[model samples]
Structures are given as structure tokens and as C-alpha cells.
Target chain A: MSVPTSTPELLRASVEQFYARHMQLLDDGDAEAWAETFTEDGLFALPGRPEPTRGRAALAEGARRAHTERLASHETHRHWHGMLDIRPQDDGSVHVRCYALVVATPRGGEPRLHRSCVCRDVLVPAGSQWQVRSRRVTRDGF
Target chain B: MSVPTSTPELLRASVEQFYARHMQLLDDGDAEAWAETFTEDGLFALPGRPEPTRGRAALAEGARRAHTERLASHETHRHWHGMLDIRPQDDGSVHVRCYALVVATPRGGEPRLHRSCVCRDVLVPAGSQWQVRSRRVTRDGF
Candidate 1:
């Protein structure tokens, strides 16, 4: 795909679309596809974790584990992201900060809030699309 | 405020910012302020409601009622919007469709998902910012 010249609105829309697709993949339990949204050596840092999960393989493994847990618990999860602050960097990367809410519903049960988090991500242009270079998620009230 | 020439990226960012402020005002129980985010004669349609809510005064009243109910229930509500599909019209209005999730947390209790809804709005320029000309919300399962 050819890279299009991005205006600020276009870039914002693209980033939002990227997150929509990425989160949906994760929610659908497609760990491999979700992991592919990141760069080959992407870094993911979670709250209270000493070492960040690095690389696509590790990322996929981590997502797989979470998917398994949700399955065993008989729940479906949805990741909702909002209130994005996007900044274009001089190094051809975009920095985004947003609120992410995880909603989980058990079979035949009402939906509940699993987590509220603030997510920070660095996205780099990969071919025509963008890929996550690094992401750090800090849970609310943590 | 001077209206800046909007690129697609700028428009997207502006819309996101609009919702951030709009939803915050509503969640914070600022009914008048939240109602002002809409046009003076804005229309709001909700699921199972035969007639849409019309005008800012009525809108404020509705919001005030919701706030009162929440206060009585000792719960706080946050509206999270995601997966926005925005279209800029030739007439200077924008059409935005998004998923909106309402998460409610009672004092000293865990957060729960109050509602999952799809929201559609037509936003028109009001001064340098945008205001909702009309909005329709449909609950996910209703």
C-alpha cells in the first residue's frame, strides 16, 4: 500500500481506526492478528510489572493467556478506548494517550467493568499503515 | 474564536475533544453545561421513546433528572465513546457514529456496565467549535 500524505484529521482518524481494529482482534481472541498490529519488536508495559513484554511472539503469547483465562471464566471482554491525545513527533512517530476501559460479561450475566486504564503508545509508520512501537498501560487507581 | 481551516486530522481531533468535554460535563452532573454542547433546538432520540427530546431546556431537564437519580443511587457514571465513524458533509455539518458505553460505579462498590449503546450525531459549527444539531442513541440489546 502506498503511504498517503496525512493531514492532522486524517492521522487522527487513522490512529482511531488502528485501535478499533487492534482492540477488536484482541477481544475476538485472535491473538496472532492482534499481535501483528505491533512492530516486530514492540514493547508492552503493564502496571506493577518489572519487565515489559517485548516482541510480537511474546505479545501474542500474553494475549493468548488472557484469552484462555477469559474463556475458562466464561466471559467475553470488550476494550473501549476514548479521549485520545495524539502528537506527531519529529522522528516520524506519533504518540497517543487515551483512556481504555475493559468491560467483561459472563455467560448470561450482566456486564461489569474489568479495568479502567490510561494507555500511552508510540506508533511508527510501517509501509502504508502504522504499527505500535511501544505501549505502556497504567491501570486506574493503581 | 476564529474558525480554523480544518484538515481531516484537525477535524477528527476536534470531534474527539468535543466528546471528551461533552461527556465529562454530563458525567459530572453539569446539566446546563452539558446541554449547551447541543444546539438550542437540538433533538435527541433514544430507544423505546416515541417522541424525541427537543430543545436545550428540555434536554437540560432530562440530564438534571438523570443526575438526580444517580446522586440518589450514590453512583457515578462515565460515558466512554469508541470506534467513531466521522463523515464531513458538503454543508459544513459532520455525521459521527460511535459506540458509547456507560460505566457506573457506586460509592464503595465495583464498577459495572450500565449500558452499551450506539450513538449517532450531526454536529454543526457553533462559533469555532462544534455542537450537536441532533443525536440518536440506540441501546445494544434493546
Candidate 2:
């Protein structure tokens, strides 16, 4: 297998683009690809929730669960992302953060902001692809 | 005058350090330094607030106003920033985004998380230091 590339600018751009695509895949209802974005032992945590979703299998299950229930049926969902920041770490890992908002539109109704959070992520090089090592979603609280 | 350095890593590091120092100055009550971090035409804006604080002088005045009333005299304020991401634009300006939390602790009371926001900044190269060209604060919404 070829060694993973670690250029800072490339890594930052790639990770960000990967995230952009990840959200798109979710909206497209591609559960497998969405889960593949994470490492085998990746972890995901949500604010105000005690238990975390861990590992690629669990991550995929979570994605499929949401995708099937939300986008595949009557309700339409769109993920909006902005304020993306990525840092290439000295050890070759990349730290990433961004703002995300989920808009849900009823079958024949207006759209509303269903949920929003700041995502803190750690990405590691996986061959030519970057995979999430861990992700934490900090929910917006007033 | 030196051409504004455009290397991605260097510019990002400089901007993050500048932001860190900017926060330190506010906590330290060094109003002059805090204000000088902005360009002559710097602007600061907040959500739900229509008007923006424009120009270095106005920026300084706003900083001093907050510092004197909250930090410099009575309560102690602490600003913490993380998830900093800087993008070096082709025009020699850099775009920055990060998460910030402000904690205020009374003389002998508990530290409270007073306010939190995601800061979006546009920084321009100014000699050896990066100056804030524009900053917008979006308060966290539940």
C-alpha cells in the first residue's frame, strides 16, 4: 500500500472537502459511504447525550437509522455547514471543526431549523483517504 | 513595505496567535493593544445587532468599554478560544473561524460561563502582525 500523504495544506483542504461530501452523502442516503468516513474504531459523541456511538459499524448503523427515517421517507432534510477550520497536527493527524445546521422540510410545508451544533473532529490519514478518529457534536444552547 | 506573506501554514499560525493575544489583552485590560490588533478600517459585528463597530478607534472604544465595566474594575473575565481554522485567501487576506467562551468570576465567587459564540474573522496581513479586517460574532442558538 502507498504511504499516506501529510502535506498541511492538502490535508486541510482534503479533510474539509471530505466533510462537505460526507454531509452530501447523508443527504443522498448513502449510509455505507457515510460510515466509511470514520475509522474502524472511530467515536462520535453528542452533547446532552450520555452514551456515545463508537466504531465504524455503530456509526454506520446510526447513519442508516437517521437516513432511512428522515430522508428516505416523506420528510426532507438538508445539512448546512460553514465556518470550517482544520489544523494539520505535528503527528500527521488533523483536527477539524465546523458549524452545521439541519433543516427539515415537511412534504408540502416550509423548512425549519431542526438542529444545529459545532462539530469538533479529529481526522487521521487512512491510505489515500482521511478518516475520522473521533467526533463530538456540541449542541447550541442559549 | 514587505509583501504580505501568503504561506498557508505561517499565515494560519500568525492569525491564531494574534487571536489568542487579542483575548489575553482583553483579560489583561490592555485596551490599547487590543484595539491595535485591528486595522484602521476594522469592523466588528454581532448577530441581532444591526450596526457594526467600524474603524480602529471605534473598536478600541468598544473594547475599553467592556473591559472597564466588567474586567478591569470589578469582575474578572477570561476568554478561551479553540477550534481555530484559518484559510489563506488569494488576495493575501485570511479567513478565520473559531469557538470561544467567556467566563466571568466575581472576586470570590464561582466562575460562570457568561457568553459563547462562534467568531468569524477576516484578517489581513499588516507587516509582521496580522490585523483583524472584519469580525462577526454569532451567538449560540438552541
Off by over 4 Å in 1: A1-13, A21-78, A81-109, A113-142
> Mind giving the per-residue lDDT tens digits that candidate 1 earns over A64-140?
99999988988778788888999998888999999988877776666777899999999998887789999999998
Q: How much DockQ does model 1 earn?
A: 0.22
What lDDT score goes with residue A85 in model 1? 95
For B14-63, candidate 1 gives per-residue lDDT tens digits of 88889999999999989999999999999999988989999999999999
DockQ class, candidate 2: incorrect
lDDT of 2 at A72: 53
List ranges where model 2 is wrong by over 4 Å. Answer: A1-8, A71-73, B1-37, B40-123, B127-129, B133-142
Give DockQ per model, in order: 0.22, 0.10
Top-scoring candidate (DockQ): 1
Q: Give the lDDT of residue B68 in candidate 2.
A: 78
Score candidate 2 by TM-score against the native.
0.60
